[model samples]
Target: MDIHYRADIKGGLLILHPAMGIVISGKVTIGKNLTLVGGNVIGFSTGINNPFIIGNNCSLGANAVIIGPIILEDEIKIGASACVIKNCINKGVTLVGVPAKEINKA
Candidate 1:
């Protein structure tokens, strides 16, 4: 997992698996207690804005791609192989499938 040096983790614990192929952009801001599984990408889309913001206690499953200038709120969970391109303002939600729709509330 290669997290860019300029990517900000604003305190608390971050659990990143060793086998995970996580790529985080330098302009990304991650909040506390983030758990990232394998093949997760948190980055900006090509020709899009930077500064992806993730809130606290968020968990990203395997192959989850969170791209562009999206904002993920607290306690959000992204399912495996999900692609998130928009802002998720609702907390405690579990997003799944392609384009990452909210399937359930945790």
Candidate 2:
């Protein structure tokens, strides 16, 4: 999907099929092979005042939420029902939990 300067998308990079429902807000950058479901939201957590940035090759699971200026590196994988509300991550890693922690390496 493509989100411009002030638009909102459910997720950054969702699948081409109907299953990947991508919703985003503000300035976000997405990658490849991302899959999402309905009701998924990726937007600015700071009440539409903050601009966000997401990295490449990342996958946000069903109902996954990404907020803040999150810079996810290449090949970053987020599990279903996960929420990210902070900093950034490296390349080739799996993130889970409420704050989206790195569980495994790629």
- Cα RMSD, each candidate: 1.7, 4.2
**Tens digit of lDDT per residue, candidate 2, span 1-106?**
4345665333444454444556666566555555555446777655454446665667777778887666667777788888988765577888898978889998
* Cα TM-score of candidate 1: 0.88
Whole-model Cα lDDT of every candidate shown, in order: 0.85, 0.66
What tens-digit string does per-residue lDDT give for candidate 1 at 1-106? Answer: 7788999887774556757577888878999888887788888867766557999999888888888688889999999999998899999999998888998887
Model 1, poorest ten-residue lDDT window?
12-21
Best candidate per lDDT, number?
A: 1
**In candidate 1, residue 25 scores what lDDT?**
83
